[model samples]
Structures are given as structure tokens and as C-alpha cells.
Target chain A: MRVGLVGAGVMGRVHAAGWAAAGAELVAVFSRDEDRARELAGQYGARVVGSYADLLREVDVVDICVPTHLHHDMALEAFSQRRHVVCEKPIALTEAEGREMIAAAERAGVRFFVAMVLRFFPQYRLARELVAQGRIGQVGVIRLKRVSYTPNKPGDNWYLDHARSGGMIVDLMVHDFDFACWLAGDVTRVYARAAGDRYALATLRFANGAMALVEGGWANPPGVFRTAIDVAGTKGVIEWSSDATATIRTFLRQPEGAAGEVGLPLSPLAEDPYTTQIKHAYEAIRTGAEFAVTPEDALRALRVALAAKESARTGRSVTLQGG
Target chain B: MTLRIGIMSAAHVHADGYAELLKQIPDVDFIGFSDEDAQRGQAFAGAHGVRWFRRHEDLLAQQPHGVIVCSENRGHMELVQMAAAAGAHVLCEKPIEVSRERAEAMRDACAARGVKFMTAFPMRFDPSVREVCARVRAGELGQILAVNGINHSENPSGHRAWFADPHLAGGGAVMDHTVHLADLLRWFFQAEVETVYAEVGNPFAQGTLSVDTAGLIQVTLSNGVFASIDCSWSRPAGYPRWGHLQMEIIGERGTLVLDAFAQALTVYAKGGARWPEWVQWGSDPNRAMIEHFLHCIRTGEEPEVTWRDGFEAMRVALAAYESSDQGTVVRLSP
Candidate 1:
């Protein structure tokens, strides 16, 4: 399959490698920054296109790796061209925009895939499998945490802007929000609180009478990232933490005149989740098998995240319709 | 004179550990224990080689200097009143009683008689917790930002059936586990909880029990530090230990993570063990707490963990239930 990549940012590079690992031909790269586009395209032996229109005409699939605010327009343009679209998460800035993209894909009879990659992470996959198999019986309470330093430095980054990135709750915690629904069911209501954009906690009540506590933070020191999940059910509980599962540690000596540094802990696996997620999308599209995460799942996750954001703003609980 | 100590009841599971500690304390005269359940009381008395009074009054008649109230949640007030009237200082089990009114009455009963009332919050005496508390108070972490706490245990219904009885225990995991973290947060920040929001569930014992077995509680303190407590009876029957208490405190300058019960020797038995057992070799907080109580009695000083601490913590737990029931944040009255 010929694939076109958009936005040569961090996610763009990650998706480029993912498509390569999934055995897809990367035909073109498009970004407003010509240098970044050419650099990423050169790594994959692909050409850099001047505009989105040219990139769309050259490939059957368009992979969008831009900021969340740009996802709606780019994916809509791809769907209009009858190309399958892969977009980074938070599907769009708002639920209405997300729905419009989903409706556009339906009208064009093309596939739309959102990268909710937590489902492809081995630990979360196994946890969901266990729950689906009734190994833990009926789901009860789920506690999920993701904490890290800010995605980019303080200034000159769109990620630090709530308008562009939707802050920490929508941009980061939406993964857990999606996973919670996948493991349990739909969220009935969300009550959330935040300490600026650095830290936030959300409580969700599920339709099955289950509950989830989802916490997200961009407050850790640099080079620090941690995630944890604990699911309790009638029969048992499943718990996993990134800190506890580390298989490697390095304490390399710094240069003579350099300041001390913090090293990220490594938990290496055979295949990374990004590649696994992209490969799954590729195979499902090829074999007519269902994608693990559908557009509606992404939309539902965005809706819950938006509700949590609203709840945090107003200091009140937000209830979803038909939850 | 050696401090005289009696146990009011053996209904709580912690009573076993407390009774063992009492026997080990060198300066205390371990009088005996009372229990309303004749069979359970006799079994405990026989196992420990101590006397069992069938009635609380019979035990109080011994005129002990202090008593540990370890009755069911609802029975705490009556036991505390009886012990206080007997002119004995009281170390009451947590959630002092079920409601705010009853807890206040218990405290008043003890205060009116000039006897001390100490809450059973052994985590206050835990060495690791003490170190973290000291460092936090010393401003080593700068201004505290947030805290995440977990206090998990196997369902107590397996050993003490009343824990699942709503009327007897007041609530389930929210009542049982939330108070420790609540008390600890209040102690750490030196602030009262301003609001509480909790999502409680009964998935663990849905068919067999009527009470909730899991709860995720969010608390905002008066100091503007928000905390999350994943307090539940979530450990399975095959889990290695009773449970654990862990806290991650985030601060502006630094962060501290404390695994209060991580000091243990993992033993993987060869005889078809279902799970590897964690045999703790660390200092016993129970013993330290009892020693502290005895010291307070001897010195005529206030207990570090006072009735107010327990009362405030119980208020948070009660608010957790209210928040869960009403599906909103429950603001605590200042």
C-alpha cells in the first residue's frame, strides 16, 4: 500500500517507522516545514511533496501526525479524496468535529483509523483479554495513571497551549479514558479536578456500575515517565506499573564538565506498541477484519475527555447523554 | 506502677496484632480481653493464655488503667463509654464510631471523665512514614503539590464477617481503608480536608455481600493539595500479604515515594504454595503505637494521634460515601 505522511513532528517520525515496519511503501511526506519533511522523507527513501493535494494524489492512505487541532481538516480532506486515513489521537479538538470527520469517512466509503495505541501495549492488551475472559470476573474499579514531564519545553510549543493540545487531560489522559471504556464499558459521568495544566484527576462512573480513577500529569522532572493500571473485579485484581517492570537500568558517567543527568528507565519489548498498532491497522484494512479501535471508540473517548475538561473547569460533575 | 491495659473486644482483625503486642510490651500488665461472642472470645483467650470476660462490664470491673476498643464499628461508642466511665484511658479502633455525632460523644465521654482517647492510627507510628512526615515538614520537598495513596487488603469477610455487614461496619472498603490515608494527609499537610469525591463499588462481593468493596476517593485539602486514595479490599485470597500502604508525594522542588510496608522477605514455599508469602521483618508499628500510648499515659501528655485526628479522618470517609451516593463532590464543613 502506498502511504503519504503529514507533519514531520515527533509523531510523524514514529508513524514513518511504523509504516515501514508494517511493510507499507512510504510514497511522500508533506509538512509546512520543508526541511523537516525532506529530512523525514529521506530516511524512508520517499519523496517530499510540496502540498497536501500533491501528497494525497500520490498515495492510497494518508497518515496524519499533526497537532490535534489540525486532525479534523486533514482527515476530512483525505476522506474526500477516497483515501483511508490514520490520525493521531484525541481524534479532533471537539466532539462535533470528530463526528463530522466520522460522517465524512462514511460518506466517502473510506476507512478512518485513530491511533489509540494503549490497546496495543502488551500489558494493557493482556489485561483486557483477562477481563474479557472473565478471569477477574465482573469489573469493579480501575485506576490508571500516566505522568511525565511536559511534552515540550515551556515556550514555543503548541503542546503547552490548551487551545492546540487540549492540555493534559485531553491530550494525554484520553488514552486511559479510551482504555477504560474498552475494559469496562461506557462512562456515565465524569468529575474531574486539576492543578493548572500540570496535574489532573478524573473519576468516571461506568454504565455497568463500575468506576475508574484516571490521573494524568505533566509535572514530573525531565526524562521521567511512568504509567500504571490496576483493575479490580469480583474474582481478582490485575495490576501493572511501568516502574515495577523495568528490565534495564543504566548509569553512564557524564563528561568531565557536564552537570548530572537523569536517565529514562527502559522496558524493552520485541516490538513497540506504535508499530504493533500500525501493523494492526494495515492488516485489518487488507484482510477486511475489524480494527481493534474503531472511529466511534475514539469519538467516545474524546467525548469523555471533553466532559472531564468541562468538569474540571466548572468544579462540577458532567454527565454524558445516553450513557 | 506498671500500666494496666485491657482489650475491649476482639471483633476487629487488628485486635489479634494488638493483643500480641500487649503481651510483648515489658512495662504493661496485659490484663485480659472481653468479647460479646462467647466462642470467639474463648478461642482468643485460650490461644493467648489470657482471661476472657463474657461481658465488657466484667472486664471493666478489673479496673484497668487503659483499654483498647476493638469492637465492631457500631459498637465502638458503647465500649468507649463503658471504658471511660470505668476511669480508663481509651485507644479506640479507627473510624472511632460510625457517625460524627457518635464519635463526638465518645470523645466527650472520655474527656468528661479526664481520661485520654487515642485513635488507632498505627501508620502515624510507622518508622518509614515518620521519616517521610519529618522530611515533608522540614520543607525538604518544598511546597507539596499532590499525593497518591493506596491502601489495599484482602476482603476481611474471610476472617471477620462483620466487615461486610453495612450496619456493623458502617461502609465497606471506603470505611475500612480510606481513614488511614485521610488521617495521614491531614497530618502531612497540617490542613483539614476541604472536599471529597469518591467512586465506590461492590464488584468484589456483589452476590455475597451488600456493601461496597472498592473505592477511589479524591480529597482536596485546605492547603490546596489534592490527593487521590485508591482504598479498597482489592487483594485476592491468594495474594502474598494482607495488603500494602504506599504514597507518592509530589512537590515543587522534589518528590517522595514511600512504600510503608515494603520491608519483607519473600518466601516461596515448596509445598504447592498458591502464592509467595511476604514475611515482614520490619519494626512492628503496632508495638510502637502501643508503647507510645503507654508513654503518653505515664507522662500525662497528649497522644500524638488524638481523638480529633480520628474524628476528622472519619469525616472524610463518611463524606466519601456521601459523595459516591450523591454523585458529586461533598464539601466538608469547616
Candidate 2:
């Protein structure tokens, strides 16, 4: 598969590495800055395309790695050219844009995949599998936190702009929103509050009667990334944290006053999540296998994030339409 | 001169720790104790080689220089009133009286009698926390922008039954765990909390427990510093220790990370104990708090953790419960 990458930023560099490990032909690279594109292209021994139009025509797959607000336009353009598309989350800044992009992909008969990389993470995958197998029965409550340092750039940092990047909730926390939905199903209501641009907390009640408290923050020191999740079920509970030596832990509901959580070790995956996601997407495109996250799945995650932002803005609980 | 201090009740989980601190301090007399649960109180007093007063008032009537009120939540006010009436400086265990009115009354009674009223916010006395606060005050971290903290603990119901009873404890983890960090943050910013929003769950016991055992609380301070606290009793039984306090403070110039109980030696032995014990090697904050309480009384000075500080911290905690109950952000008055 020939892949042309867009927006040679941090994520662009990450995806370029992913594509190389995925064994895809990195046909070309495009960035608004010619120097960035040239740098990435040189590193990967790929050609640098001068324009988005030229990059679209150069490869079979278009990977959009630009700022979130540009996702709709780039994905739309990719679909218009009949190229298979992989867009990073959140699919777009608005639901309307998300719908239009999905519709465009459907009309063009091209595969549209969103890089919700959490689904590719080994621990999260195992957690979902365990829940599916009812290792922990009758899910009741979940708590997820993804905290990191603020992304500070010298100039024109799109992430600091809420309109462009949707701030922390849509940009950073959308991962947890997607993961929570995947674990507990569609959200029925959301109550949230934000502390400036850095911190946000949201409580989501799922249609299945499970509740999830999702917390995200961008106030820590630079390069500090911490993620933790706790899922409580009828028969037991499952927990995992990035800071722990153990990968995952589970506690069965024993008789009263018994020990909780038998620590379980995870078999480390060979490939990083980025590489795995990239490889999975490429394989799905070639073999017609199911992708880890569909455009609609990404859209549902976006809706929950938007609902959280709305709740934070209005100081009231926001109800969602069932997907 | 030795400052005589009496323990009011042995009901609080920290009662034994306080007694130990009193014993360790050379200048403090570890006087007798009293509790409504006479057998339990007598057992504790006997274990510590102190007299067991049949009536709680009898212990107060000893006219000790200071009294450590370690009764259950609802019993704090009466103990404080009795200790204050006996002209002893009162060192009340936190969430001061569980209600703002009761807490204020305790403070007023102490003030009218010219007695020092100290809230036992031992976290404020933690050496690591004190160092961080000192740096912040010195402008070493610049203007504090945000604070995040966690006070995680084992299910207190495993430690004491009263912890699961809302009537006796006022609230659950939100009440028991919130005040320590709340007091610390207030001290750090020298400001009151202006607004509070909280999310709580009973994930540990799946609501089979009477009170909530988990909480995530956000507070916006009058000093423009935003803070969040995870006051949860979700620690596992086999966890190394009962709990630890952790905080991350982000400032304009620098950031500070504080683990209040991080200086510990973990003992891991096969077939030795149910859990690997994390023996704390750090300075004992409880001892510092007791010494400070005695020093305030000896010098006729107000306590660093004054009754008003306790009231404000308790008010913020109570507001957190209300916010969780109402499912909205609650604003506090100045």
C-alpha cells in the first residue's frame, strides 16, 4: 500500500515511523512548510509532494495528521480523490463535519478509518476482551484518567486554541471517551466542569446503567504522560495504570473481608500502538478486514466529547441521543 | 515544663497514633483517656499505661494543658466544648464537627474561654508538604497556577465500622479524606475555595456500602489557583500501605511534585505477612502536629491550623458533597 502523509508535525513524524514499520510504501509527504515535509521525506527516503492536490494523486492512502480543525477539509479532499483515508481523532471539530466526512467516504467507496490508537494498545485491548468474556461480570462503574503536560509551542500552537483543537476534552480526552464507550456502551448523560484550558472532569452515565468518570488534564510538567483506568463490575473489578509495574489487576467478588485484585501481568506487544494501528489499518484496507475503529465509532466518541464540552460550558448535565 | 495532654475518645482510628506521639514527646505528659465505649477506651488506656476515665468529663476535668479530641465525627463538638470548658487547648480531629454550625460553635466556645483550638490536619505538618509550601511562599515556583492531589486510602470500613456510617462520620471519603488536602491547599494559597464541583462513586463496594467510598473533587480558590483532589478509599487490601498523599503543583516559573509519605522502606518477605509492609522512614507529621498543639498552648499563641482554617476546609468539603448531590458547580461566599 502506498501512503502519503499530511502535516509533518509531531503526529506526522509518529505516523511516518508507524507506516515504515507497517511495511507500507511511504510514497510522499506533504506539509504547509516545505522544509518540514523535506525533512520527514528525507528521513524516510520518501518523496516530498509540493501540494495537497499532488500528494492526493501520489498515493493510494492519505493519512491526515494535521491539526484537528483541518481534518474535515483534508479528509474530504482525500475522499474526493477516491483515496482511502486515515484521519486522526477527533474525526472533526463538529458533528456536522464528521457526518459530511463519513458520508463523503461512503459515497466515494473508500475506507475511512480514524486513528483511535487506544483500541490498539495491548492493555486496553485485553481489558475490552476481559469485559466481553465477563471475567468481571455486570459492569457497574468505570474511571479513566489521561493526564499530561500542556503542549507548549513557541508560535501558533493550535492546541491552545479551543476553536481549532477543541482544547483538552476533544483533543486529549477523546481517547478515554472512545474507550469508555467501547467498554460500557453509549453514553446517556454527561456532567462536566473544566478548570481553565488544562483540566476537565466529566461524569458519563451509560445507557446500560454503568457510570464512568473521565478525567483529563494538561497541567503537569512537560513530557509527563500518565493514564489509569478502573472498571468495577458485579463479579469483580479490573484496573490498570501506566505508572504501575503490573500491567493489569483484577479483583473477584469474594466473601466479605477478602483481598481484592489479583495482580496480572500483560504480555507486551511487539509493535507500538501507533505501528499496530497503522499496520491494522493497512491490512484492513487490503484484505477487507474490520478496522479497529470505524468512522461512526469515532463519531460517537466525538459526540460524547462535545457533550462534555457543552456540560462544562453550561454547568448542567447534557443528555445525548443514543447512537 | 511538661504539657499535660489527655485523649478524649479512642474511637478515631488515629487515636493510638496520637497516644504514641504523646508518649514519644519528652515534654508532653500522655495523660489518661475517656470514651463512651468504656471497654474499648479502657483497653486503649491500659495498653498505653494511662488511666481510663469512666466519664468523658472526668478526663476533661483533669485540666490537662491540651486535649486531643479523637472521638467519632458527631462527638467532636461535645468533646471540644468539654475540653474548652476545662481550660485546655483543644486539638480536634478533622472534618471538625461535620457541620458548619457545630464547628463554628466549637470555635466560639474556645475563643470565649481564651483557649487555643487546633484542627488536627497532620498533612500540614508533613515535612515534604511543608518544604513545598515554603518554596511556593518563597516565590521559587512563581505564581501557582494549578494543583492536583490524591488522598487514597484502604476502605476505612475495614478499619472501623463508624467510617461506613454517614450519621457518625458526616460523609464518607469525601468527608474523611477531603479536609487534609483542603487544609493544605488553603495554607498554600492563603485563600479560600470560591467554587467546588465533585463527582463521587461507590465503585469499591458497588453501593452495597452505606456511604460513598470514592470521590473526585475540583475546587477553584479565591487566589485563582485551581485544584482537584481524589479523596477515595479505593486502595486494595494487599496494597503495601494504608494510603499516601500525593500532589502536583504547577506554577508560572516551575512545577513541584510532593509525595507526603514517599520516604518509606518496603518490607517484602515470602510467607511473612498478608501484605508487604511499607515501613515509613519519613518524619512523623502526627508528632509534629502534637508538638505544635502543645507549643501553641504553652506560648499562649494561636495554632497554625486555627479553628477558622478547619471551618473553611470543612466548608469546602461539605460543598463538595453538595455539588455531587446537586450535580452542578457550587459557588462559595467569601
Candidate 3:
């Protein structure tokens, strides 16, 4: 399948590599700067387009890699050309823009997916599978803390501006919010707090007693990368620590002890998730498979991120807005 | 029914705590102690009133029912394996085996042997921590969203020479202390660590520790709770050594911050040269731990602390180690 790329920035470069790894032929590339597009196009052996309209008219599937606010317009442009759409996370800056993109995709009879990469992460996907399998009994709660030192790279500073990136909630945490919904179901309310554009703490209440605590921060002291999950229930508990990707510790209630999980719980896919996601998008066009993580799921995640911001601002719980 | 116990080393400070616990129990007998540093072992055995053997094999040969592998951070696994192979249950000290691969192997070995293999994480014995666990599980705190852990000690861990070697202590304050906070967080909220971004370094151990004597770990748990822990050996010198530990648990209904090792009195005295007043506090966590381990062994019923309890603490140590290496949030293994 042939593909066209927009926005030759960090994510653009990543997706280009994924497209190549996934065996998607790059038909064309587009960026705000002609020279940038030409440079990427030359490297990838693909043609360069100066206008979004031209790129959409050329490629079968348009992958939107632009900044958050431009996503809806660009995806809408692709839909206008009858091209399927695969967009980066936080599908749009607002729910209305997300709605527009969803409507456009559905109206054009094209496939739409939001790049919620956690769906492909081994531990995350495995957690969903295990919870669904009732390995830990009933789903109880989820607590996520995602933080990193502020990125000092050139041009990446746009994330610090709330007008563009939606700060930590959208740029970093909406992924967790989406995962919470997927793992626990539709969120009902949110309680949250944020300090400037750097840090936020949000709590999501699902319709079930299962709940979630999500924290995202832009600034951190650099040293190590650490993430983990602890699932508890009526029968057993499962705890996975990132340091050992294959090991999951579990404890059954009556046994008086917990044991490390057996068998491989990590993903078998060797390539980056973007590679798999984009390939799935391409496959959907040819085979009509359901999109991996749909636009509505992305919109639902955005609702949580926005609600997190609102709850943090007012120091109260905000309801999750569904599409 | 009594549990026979042996010691593998004397390098860790908690060795003394273990010896004292054994002395407190009528059913627990100190089988023997093995240390590479013969003099140190002799001195330790003399102080604890136990026999000292020159080689680890001698201690394992005792065929004790259980062993406390309290050697240097690097020696945890070898000793635990020896004890487990000798048909004995094992209690390896926290900062369990430096790396996850080794820890998993050791855990597997114990599993295969059908012997109880535990990492020594005595703090789960704290009354307040247990209180938090019961209350949270019962929905007393409602839905837990955020948690903060503060661990401060006079003369951060780098005060010891061996602690400075990443080879010996596994990174620094983050590796040493995260286990306590992580394990507690796991038990308190019944959550797993989902992702962790950590900043680890030494601030004051200019001459001593290889790992940072001070560090911070901010983690996201599997249950979607935001958590932060500030850990350091930053307390003033010539003060109490037990350290100060506190936790703030946030839930849907209310927030609870408990000072698990809170000392009742604080003495502040003015300095002669326009300096801030010197303050002092005390704690009894060690004694609490001694009581719990003994009680668990005596009852033969489940104890307050369990094997999974130790793994939670060890997992945090691995998380901080990984986060410091990758410079991003690391997802824990499945």
C-alpha cells in the first residue's frame, strides 16, 4: 500500500521509519516548508508535495503528523480527497474538532484511527488481556504516573505552550486516560489538579467501581525510566514492573503469598508500535479490518484530558464527555 | 514447627536487626553465620551471640529451615540460592538482587524448590501502613488517586563506603529507598507501578556514595494513580539514625497523610553562631519489624508481610534504576 506523510517533525520522522519498516511504500511527503519536505522525500525516495490538497489527491492513506491543533483540518482535508486517515494522538485540540474529524471520516466512508500506541505496548495490551481474562479477578483500579524532564531540544518547546499542546494532559497523559477507559470502561467523572504547564494529577471514576489516577509532568530529574502496573481483585493481584518486562508478580488471596507470572506477557511484535498501527491502517483499506483504536476512542480520551484540565482548574470533579 | 535460621553476611546494617529478632524469639535459633570478612563475621557473631563460620557452605550445611541473606547488595542471589538449594526457605534483604533478570531467576529458583523465598522488607509491619491498606481496600479513602512518600535520613546512605559503588549498592538512594516506598504503595493502594520517570543523583555525599545520597522517584502505578517519592540521606548529622518516613494518600473522598515513623517529640536548640536551630526526632520501626517476623513464624498462619510484599519493594528499586538509565518513564514488565 502507498502512503503520504504530512508534518516532517519528530512524529513525522518516527512514522516515516515505521511506514518503511511496515513495508508501506511512501508515495509522497508534505510539510509547511518545501525544503523540509523535499529533504525527507529525497531521503525516503518519495515525491514531495507543497500543498496538503495535492498530497491528499496523491496518496491512498494520509497519515496526519502535524501539531495537535492542525490535526482536524488536515484529516478533514484527507477525507475531502476520499483518503483514509490515521492521525497522531489527541485527535484534535477540542471535542468539536474531534467530532468534525469523526463525522468527515465516517461520511467519506474512510477508516479513521487515533494513534493510541499504548494499545500495542506489550505490558499495557497484556494488562487489558489479563483483566479481561479475569486472571486478577474483577478489575479494580488503575493509577498511572507519567513524567519526564522538560525536553530541551530545538522547536520541541511548543509543547510547553498550553495553546498548542494542551500541556501534560493531552501531550502525555491522554494515552493513559484512553487506556483507563479501555481497561475499565467509560469514565463517569474526573477530579484533578495541575501546576502550570508542567505537571498534573487527575482521577477518573469509571461506571464500575474500578477507578484511575493519572499524573503527567513535563519536568523531571533525569536518570531512569520507570513504569509499573498493580492490579488487585477479589481473588488475586498482578503487579508488573518495567525493569523486568517478562516478569509479573501475582498473589492469590488464600495462598498467603504471590508468585511471579509465568509465560511471556510482552508483545511478540518486534517493530515499533507505529509500524504496526500504520500497517493496520493500510490493511484496513485493503481488507476492511476494524481500525485498531478508532476516532471515537481518541475523542473519548480527549474528553478525559480536557476534563482533567477542567477539574484541575476548578478543584472539582468534571464529567466525561462522550462522542 | 520452629524455624531454624542462618545468616550469610554482615555487610548490611540490617544484619543487626535480624540478629536481634532471632534473639527475641524462643522458637528461632541462630544456626550459624558465614562472612567473607572473617573478622567482621567474628565480631558480628560475638555481638549477636552466634557462631561464625569462614565459608558460606558451612552456614548452608547447617540445613537450617530458613536463612537471612544479608550480605553486600551484589551477593544477595548467590546466598539465597545456596540456602534454597540446601532445602531452606530464604529471606534476602531488600534491594533484592541488583538486576531484574537475576531477581526473577532467584524468584524462579525458589518457586521450583517449593521453598519460601522472600526479600526482607520489614516496613510492611508498620501499623499505620496496614491501617492504610485496610481502609483503602474497604473504600474508606474512597478511590485513591495520588500518593507521596517522603524518606529522609540523617547522613544519607552514601555515608557508608560500600554504598558508593554502583556494583555494591545498585545506584544510590533511589535503589536503596524506592523499595520501601514502592512496596508500601503497592500494599497501601493495592496498585502496581505502571510507569516511572526518575531523577537520581548525589547532592551531599561529595566524598562517600557512588550512587546519589539523595534522589527522587515520581511514578505512575498500574491502577492509574499518580505518585511521587522524595528520598535522601539528607537529615542533619548527630541526630537519630532510624530516618523519617511519611505518606500522603489521596482518594475520592479524602486525603490521608500518615507519618509511619513519626516521633512524638521534637527538640530544637539554637546555635551559637546565628544558625538554624538543631532539631531531633526518634522512631521505632525496627522493633515493630522484629515483632512481626517472629509472630508470623510462630503462628504458621499468614503473616502481615508476604513474599509478594517483598517483590513490590524490589520492583520499585528496579523501576528507579531503569528510569535513571533511559531518562524517560519506563513501563514495568508484564
- Relative to the true structure, how large is the alpha-carbon lDDT of every model? 0.89, 0.83, 0.69
Docking class of 1: medium
> Could you tell me how far off, in angstroms, the CA of residue B317 lies in candidate 2 after the best superposition?
2.0
Per-prediction DockQ, in order?
0.63, 0.21, 0.01
Off by over 4 Å in 2: A35-59, A80-82, A107-109, A123-157, A180-270, A307-323, B270-274
Angstrom error at residue A229, model 3: 2.1
Cand. 3: chain B TM-score = 0.86
lDDT for each residue of candidate 2 in A1-323, tens digit (9 for 90 to 100)? 89999988877888999999888999899998789899999999999988899998889999999889999999998899899999888899999999999999999999999999889888899899999998877676677878776776545788889889998899888999999999989998787767666677777877876767787877655545677887766555677877674455555555632321111112356777888889999999989898878988899999999999998888677878764
Q: Estimate each model's TM-score.
A: 0.96, 0.87, 0.51
* Quality of candidate 3 docking, DockQ: 0.01
Top candidate on TM-score is: 1
B42: Cα error in model 2, Å: 4.2
lDDT of 1 by residue, A82-168 (tens): 999999998998999999999999999888899998888889999999999999898888889887766653224787788888988
Runs of candidate 3 with Cα error greater than 4 angstroms are A222-224, A244-269, A321-323, B1-334
What's the TM-score of chain B for every model shown? Answer: 0.98, 0.96, 0.86
Ranked by lDDT, the better of candidates 1 and 2 is 1
Clashing pairs in 1: none
